[model samples]
Target: MPVIEIENLRKTYSMDGGLSVEALCGVSLCFESGEFAAIMGASGSGKSTLLNILGCLDPPTAGRYLLNDDNVAALEGERLAALRNENIGFVFQSFNLLSRTSALENTELPLMYNHSGLGMTEIRRRALAALDRVGLAERADHHPNQLSGGQQQRVALARALVNEPSVLLADEPTGNLDSRTTLDIMALLQQLNDQGMLIVMVTHEQEIGAYTRRILEMRDGLIIRDSPVENRRHARAEASGESTTRLNATES
Candidate 1:
């Protein structure tokens, strides 16, 4: 069975005139284990809506969502929160780190809520390991303000993975970074995907989408196309005598 499933999921936002704006119009999808996926769409194209539902941060208006075969649409309140905390990790474009906390402390925050019996020492150990995975272990003691934007983002990503959730949901992860930092983060995500982590990312940029195995494109609250990367695309770029620049690992 797929690790995640959605059946006819729909969400509508009601306006003042009793008119409704449908954000997701009964979209259905399933995610396989360890697959790297890119969710791409124009603005107002339901990418955020779909992501929000999948992350368990928002409920669908009408449809069935089965995550790990459990009826997610039927879950509510603390049940939904517990399920989300246990099964999903999120990396946002804004790098929403606590302003006053160190990187290690920020990464350790989630474990404090995981109900684990491990003490603070174990939590720090695990958080450091997660930071190492994202190549941010050296910045463990740095607060968000003390780090560069890219470094802060890496710290936020470390916090997301510290719990080892089943799915990693990233919304515009590279949107705020320069091109170089974007590739570094993309490479890190690729490495994680290769190591059997399921990743679902939302992006409007084709460069970032190229790193994923599959792309789901949306428009006007509907999925327009679901496809694999076209070989011709790479061929065309190469034909134009273009070269891709690599991100400097040490920058972040």
Candidate 2:
């Protein structure tokens, strides 16, 4: 079964004078396990709105969304929050780490909301493992202020991973990093996806989107093009100064 399934998803916003704006217009998509996909569009194209709905941050005005076959489109309050915490992990552009919290502590915060009954030792162990996966284990004791942008983002990624969520949702995760650091983060994300983590990312940068396996181009609240990347860029190879070649979509 697909990790995520949405059918005719719609989201509208109320404006002044009893007017409304349709942010999403019957958008439907599915993402399977281990798939790494990117959503790209210009400003006001509804990519952010779509991501918000997917992340469980907002409910769709209409339609169905199934995460691992559970209907979550209309879930609200504690139920929605619980479902989000249990099944989805989020990484944002701002690296939303607590200012004074240590990396390990920040990574452990998600577990506080978990009802799994895991003890502190197990929680710390999982957090450390997640940090190690992101190559930040050595920095676990450091605060966000003491780390570089890339390092802080890794901590954010580790925090997102600590819950072992079924789907990883990233919104402009590389937006604040330099090109080189962005490549590093993409490489890490690719590795995780290779290990069977479903990753959905929103990016406006074509260069960044090239790192993913599939691209969905959005326009005016609809996906205009959905195609597999013919010439998927390998960040490890790119970081080593290799010349990359592009292929036609049919070649994929």
Candidate 3:
């Protein structure tokens, strides 16, 4: 099933004068359930604009956006906020964790805003479980400063997963990590994707993009290329210095 669908989506930003910048230009796309895909482009290519609209952080100036079969453009105010909180999860390049809070507490931040009637006990339990999924349960009490960059990103990922969202959106998720740590993070992501979590990531690096099952390259506010990986990178295999199969890319 298609969890996300956008048709002729457009976004524009107005300037002081009678002028505007079109960030997204009549872009149409669909993401099915359990799909692992990446959006790639240089600066000003509208990849971020499209991601914002999909995550419900911004509304399109024109066109339809459907999330889990609901028309997202039709929602406003609290309704939109609720939809975003309930179904979409986000991870950023910065790791975005609070400096003062413990890893568990950082993961609990999303649930705090949800108002789902979950008690503190239940919330903590869920948060801990999320941390455990990312292999950081033992360090739950550690502050951001105490954790390494990769561990911090794991906390961020756990926070995103705590809500049981329909899809996970990551923007340059490993941009701050070293190469070895990048592989570790990507391995965790691959494990999650294997277990049927839908993931869409935005990255400028082709090597990082190679880990995903599909790649969508955007340019000038349009998707110039949409191709499936004939041979997707297996994070664990590469991490162990084992050979990974690669097939020729065929257009989709």
Candidate 4:
């Protein structure tokens, strides 16, 4: 079964003044494990709307969304929330870190929120490990303001991975950083993909999207182009000496 599925997903919003806007008309796609895909579009192209639905942050007005073969669009209440927490990791363009908390605290927030059975010691350990994955272990004691834009983003990425989700969804992750920092974050994401993490990113920059195995261009709430880079797995494998980099994702 496909890890993620979206079929004819539709979303429409009605404003207070009775203005109805159709964000997504009818879109369909499927994502498999260990795939790194980029979704790109211009403003008002419904990229964010589609991403929200895929991440379970919002519901579509009409659609068939299956996360691990379960109809996520049909789930409600705690079931929906639990599925989201268990299967998805989210990263935003802005490094959404708390102001006064240490990086370790921020990374542990997910496990602390849903998995209260874990002792603080274990949470701290896993949090630090996630920090190490992003090469931010030394900065685990630092707060958001103390780190560079790239470092802060890495902290956020660590927080997302601390839960060990099936898919990592990033929305405009490089929007706030400089060119150098953007490249650094992209490299980190490349490394994560190499580690067999399924990643779906929304970006406006073509250069950043080039790093992914697949590029999905969305326009008017539909996927217009879905193209894969030739030899993407080979490119990834040569980047690191890790068995995870050898894993390949299968699409339906």
List clash counts for every candidate, in order. 0, 0, 0, 0
Give per-residue CA lDDT, model 4, range 1-252, as digits (tens): 578988999999998899989989999999998899999999899999989999988989998999888898888868877877778889999989988999999999888876457898999999999999999999899989899999999999999999899999999999998866776788789889888899999999887788889999999888899999664433233344333434442221
Give the residue spans of candidate 1 off by over 4 A: 231-252
Q: Write the number of the candidate with greater TM-score, choosing between 3 and 4.
A: 3
**Which residue pairs of candidate 1 clash?**
none
- lDDT per residue for candidate 3 within 1-252, as digits (tens), equals 799999999999898888999898899999987789999999899999999899999999999999999999998778888887789889999999999999999999888889678899999999999999999999999999999999999999999999999999999999999988999999999999998888999999999999999999999899999999777888887876632222222322
TM-score of 4: 0.89
lDDT of 2 by residue, 1-252 (tens): 899999999999999999999999999999999999999999899999999999889999999999888899656678888877888899999999999999999999898888888899999999999999999999999999999999999999998988889999999999999988998899899999999999999999999989999999999999999999888999877765632333333355
- Each prediction's Cα RMSD? 4.7, 5.7, 6.0, 7.4
Clashing pairs in 3: none
Better of 1 and 2 by lDDT: 2
Instruction: Pick out the ten consecutive residues of candidate 1 with the lowest summed lDDT.
Output: 232-241
Ten contiguous residues with the weakest lDDT in model 3? 243-252
lDDT of 1 at 82: 77
- The weakest ten consecutive residues by lDDT in model 4 span 243-252
The 10 consecutive residues of candidate 2 with the worst lDDT sum are 242-251
